[model samples]
Target: MEKKVTLPKHKFHIQAGDTVVVIGGNSKGLRGVVKEVIVEKDRARVEGVAMITKHMKPTASNPQGSLVKTEGSVHISNLMVIDPATGEPTRTGRKVNEKGKLQRFSKKTGNFIPDAYRKQ
Candidate 1:
């Protein structure tokens, strides 16, 4: 029998509820909150970017068949995390804080993001 080994999922600096800006694609320059992050696929679903329309038949939820609008997953490479301190898009880095806790910080301005801004 052959044994299969699974690789660990990729880690991302972006997290849910983080404010992000689309740097490329049709939604370029648009800002939205991170609804979900797919670490394995390196994609994220933003609140208002990459809108797509889907046609669905009538179901229990929808009495009538209609077009539903939704946001599609955006590639991580095309998205940039917005720095709360600078109000600009910047790369993120992880560091150990003075209390010996892992914290996310902006590489651009070297500002550490407070816990209040991150989603628990």
Candidate 2:
């Protein structure tokens, strides 16, 4: 008998440092850079995307319990890549520039991602 191997599905195409816009959920229309990508869970944490307040229980670390506000992870399906030039959400595609450098650009804005963090 032959053994069959199954692989998991990966949905989100965006990677860390990529600016994305929230397309669905409670935080719809919000734009932020991807801080982390949880590929196994099909979720990505976007900087300043999902904000939630939690009550922390005091422990040895802190004698006082307090309310904390933190960013929450969003499903990859809810996010769309944002164009660096126009600041609008768009699909990402790679192409070689005049200098033969590989560059990613927004299909909607027709502009390449900023050079500062484009390497990632």
Give candidate 2 regions above 4 Å deviation. Answer: 1-11, 95-103, 114-120
Q: Model 1: runs farther than 4 Å from truth?
A: 1-4, 60-63, 115-120
Clashes of 2: 0
Candidate 1: how many backbone clashes?
0
Q: What TM-score would each prediction reach against the true structure? A: 0.84, 0.70
Residue range with the least summed lDDT across 10 consecutive positions in model 1: 111-120
- Scored against the true structure, residue 13 in model 2 reaches a CA lDDT of 55
- Residue lDDT tens for model 2, 51-113: 889999998888898899888899988999877677678887788887898777778866766
lDDT of 2: 0.81
Per-residue alpha-carbon lDDT of model 1 for 88-114, expressed as tens digits?
Answer: 999988899888988989999988876
Measured on C-alpha atoms, candidate 1 has an lDDT of: 0.88
What's the CA RMSD for each of the models? 2.4, 3.7
